[model samples]
Target: MRSSFKSSFGSQSTHRPHKMGYFSSRILPSEPSHFTKLYFDIAPGQLPIVYRDEYNVHFLGLEKLHPFDAAKWGHIFQYLKEAGVIDETAVVKPNEASDEDLSVVHTRQYLDSLKWSWNVAAIAEIPPLAVVPNFLVQSSYLRPMRFQTGGSVLAGKLAVEWGWAVNLGGGFHHCSAGRGQGFCPYADITLLVRCLLAHSPAVKRAMIVDLDAHQGNGHELDLGSCRNVYILDVYNSGIFPQDFKAKAGISRNVELRHYTQDDEYLNAVEENLEAALQEFHPDILVYNAGTDILEGDSLGLLSVSAEGIIRRDELVFTKARDHRVPIVMLTSGGYQKRTARIIADSILNLFNKGLISRTNRNVR
Candidate 1:
């Protein structure tokens, strides 16, 4: 039997599936597995938005050394709450993914490597973390990633049942099964898609729509060879993780130059996505929505306006809805302090445009 937990939105749960037959009238997985605890029955009253405060990383001011926003997850939720887009009672809290949970995709050697602070410090790109004790690193950093990773896994299941789901934190596209980079310590995107394909009966083909400014070389290396997993990557050619070898994994690739602006970027996304969908229909869509593409984002090196980001999200959600494909959205790479507000605003735009809502449950 699968595990279950009850809690108010924004509230933490000790731990963390499905009814709409939304995934093809298939029965749930019955045998015991590492995924049982991650897949549970959720009440209809809850929205498929998964998050928890534990997703934030707080250390002895060490997190500030990295440009990435450590508190972006909490900020996004708080903004949504302040805007009345969500309440404490409406969202689903996720469990921290255990070592066993991560074992589904990550190599045992890679998992064991995290026991060393030096290794973790390298993965997080926070050189100062190397001197910190392993326990402190785990508690202050990796633990939070575990929770977001778990949220991504849970959101995959939720998306199939609810037609769509958003994990407020996640989109660790730079971590593969055996390696972690670009501040991504776990292959959450890989795990999410792998879980759905392995356990969800209806999901035979999954499409990853990665719009992060940097290439999603992590998941590309992990899932690229799978015939059933199609990837559409739109990234700046000049950015990090320019894994040329991983380019083979992308079923459709759209490369952008440095300082590429809205019209060209958005047009490429819309055109390639439309063409990709027409060529390879998927049972589920994993949208890696990264706010790092904003104009002033130094790391992203793109010139997309905040409104462009919103429109990009809207376009993805709208296409998914129009095509009747369930989508699971992940807040990927966004480095700026304002990235959180931009994410919240984009989500609000999604809500306002009726692209995402509780009422549009997959009840059929």
Candidate 2:
């Protein structure tokens, strides 16, 4: 049966759909802004999944020096196509985020800082980028990130209107409004949350479910004081970015030990996530699904198998579906060469389990 959950507005871009009548509407923006281009409506036939070919970062083989698989986003999409889950036309392509759009969250000084190649290199943690020309750096690296940032913003609206959305290339959790680090240059998660709260009338309160291996200090720093936002972060305590100050922002914190296995890891997730849902009712859920915790990953320093990764994704999606909260998922941080395949498999598992669908059924 065709699901009754259709977008609140069609291709013309109107107010959020009638299905969101359950939540009281907030005040709409008095004047339209340039950021509206990022929230333009998608066709009903297109899935909420957002991706673009330009999302892959490639630059004179410099990207190979970094541990990150720069082309992972493209590879995931290819696998999904091979699995017959989606084709090129079925996916939603997002526009690149403009300076004005990014100003919604970033400081003007920080935005100006990126024009220097040295600054870009430092933020991306790639020393080679320091020697590269600024224009080349912009084209080969920063442009793709801008597109991914735009995807995150668009996916936020898509999730609210259609119940679920996935951006194939975002989750820059280490970058705050003023600083970028850990290979994350832009705070896409923060931008998404800010844009939604300002524009999506039905989404007054938002929840961030950050299951990444590293601490999500960036968003915590950005939204920590926000009473309307709830954060639940489950990460390896022994890993990088141990920001005690950022811990102040987390409503529910699960700090796992080094080399924690699947049973213990999954248990903590289930317990804390369930408790968090009971404590707060969110209109939208931002899920940072990072796969770096796989057993052999040297950086994440944990021991979750590929099967465990799949199960973990299922658990989160099931909880979101049961709660009827709109979800937008981001592929955060995972460095292994095989990480792409694991992500593809986990997403496929979600589809087979009926946790996500093109029609976005079973949502209020």
Candidate 3:
């Protein structure tokens, strides 16, 4: 018979250390356990951003996937291996998002526009421009926004089934029902949430905790009328997409001033998130853990540090654990020297600790 806790905490309890022996004896198959999937869509050979003028100080680093991201994720994988949290069979890969999947949250007109832009840019034989009028750059030279959107949906599904999953990219919260804006091709987070609602009965209620430097305006618009969804965005005020409005009364759109510190930021998160948790009582939490809040981040105006980021994750993860709600984490935005690794490590660390606690409980 399945353990009682198995139904409560989802599948994680089945792999608890004390239960491992029982699992191996009764349920373990001849086939090896699959490693947790980490989805990625960015091409490896993309060029770093460059500018002609010496005074321009181009963010060349932004062009290519940062080395630190891979390193941090690699470190986390190593830690998981040492702790036996994952098996050798774990794998990572790119996932494609279909038009049907995107239609769950986006209009067909917007989706076609993205494809049209890509084709037109190709036919014109012009290198992709990051900033273009009347066209949302879905596919940049470095990151294809569609791939990231698809990856988020794939990761969310995997997390539901396996107890945890991560998307190496995504956090494009600026896309809307009729249009895609703010460097995001599609509202990836919103799309994923819609997918969950369609496919998973376990996810009756969901709370989106967006900690990106920019406000999740698009998500607010897309999920505003969603009866069972709640959105809480903590972002800098007076930035892009000016004249912000919260259509959903449940939405808590807190705007911070420029140069906010780590403590101040986290305090806001703790306070607002606590309130949201009490009121919403969601079954699932989707966190847009953006690294842009880091002090050195190019676009982030906040002064949050690395340790601060960890604290934020801990607070949110602990809430999910206490509520016995599963979490789907998406990498929203991070544009520092080694932002990817830092973001990846932070997520892995959360899982590592959660696993350890479960193991300890089993032993006791």
Candidate 4:
């Protein structure tokens, strides 16, 4: 008997059948766990951007098979540097999230289950990874996810302090406390929310503006019922993880049809977001900015153009900033080769619009 929506696909999944069987019947952790200093002080010249080299996945060329650009973070970083906007000395380097940190949101049973290579392979959507040894999978695959998870947590704090922050990676919005799916291994978005709620007294209320091509069922499963979090999701009506159960939890929802173009997409975003802001004023906004909506993306079949995507980002940032709400942006679910370049362009647009700025923090 499948208990959740994810496990319901057990009979349907021909590729990897282990997804459902892996879900053990166990109680989730109830209390919050202590974590290390995922956040740090930034000196002059440092941008509130979070990234690290380990965020890239390069193992035996197996990552090439996936539609995703595993090293897209590196590409975005290089482009920014080439543009003379940022250098290695400026970006924030995040520490790998330890077991203690993850346990704050994930169950002990779920964490233990990831020790198997097959499990990690399933979450990563790479069939070749199932052959890799468990230890190697831990280091090569899961380690980078941990780093990105920590980056998301750190970005939450940076956004509150600096008024805005961006994690070059993360936005694992499809993984919840007890489950992982849609190439998302960790519940980083949930972790960031918990961190902010616990750390910042000013951030009493938060909003998740999920504009990904697909539904953010992971964070929806985790934070849906919480009164403190308001979710305004705009995703393709026809797509993966068609989680109607999760959709019921959204405070505001805009379901776009397949191949929806820029005008329709942008208009929906602006109107819905404006309405959400009017209904509930948040102390902070967490934007799941996925570039998968680019026209050529196989998985994200939406036809939003590169230029439209850039304008979309600018619109979101402008709204959040104008509302005096601290915001954190995460680069999620962009699969095509051009996704990284478009992302870089959008960040540049944000800077040009004065929505985000260089903090110029001194070297620590």
Cα lDDT, all candidates = 0.85, 0.85, 0.57, 0.83
lDDT of 1 at 103: 90
Candidate 3 residue 287 Cα shift, in angstroms, is 0.5
lDDT of 4 by residue, 66-128 (tens): 889989999999888888778889989998998989998899999999998888888999988
Among all windows of 10 consecutive residues in model 4, the one with the lowest summed lDDT is: 9-18
lDDT of 2 by residue, 1-364 (tens): 1112212211111111112332233332322244457888898689998999999998799999888899999999999999999889998999999888888778999999999999999988789899999999999999999999999999999999888899998999999989988988899998898888878778888899999999999998888667677888888878889998777767677777788789888887887788788878999999999998889888899899999999999999999988999999999999898989999899899889888887756265
Best-to-worst ranking by TM-score: 2, 1, 4, 3
**Backbone clashes (count) for model 2:** 1
Segments of candidate 2 deviating more than 4 angstroms: 1-35
TM-score of each model, in listed order: 0.90, 0.90, 0.68, 0.90
Candidate 1 per-residue lDDT, tens place, 190-262, comes to 8898788878887888899999999999998887766677788888878798898787667677777888888
- In model 1, what is the error at residue 126, expressed in angstroms? 0.7
CA RMSD of each candidate after superposition: 10.4, 9.5, 13.7, 8.2
lDDT of 4 at 136: 86
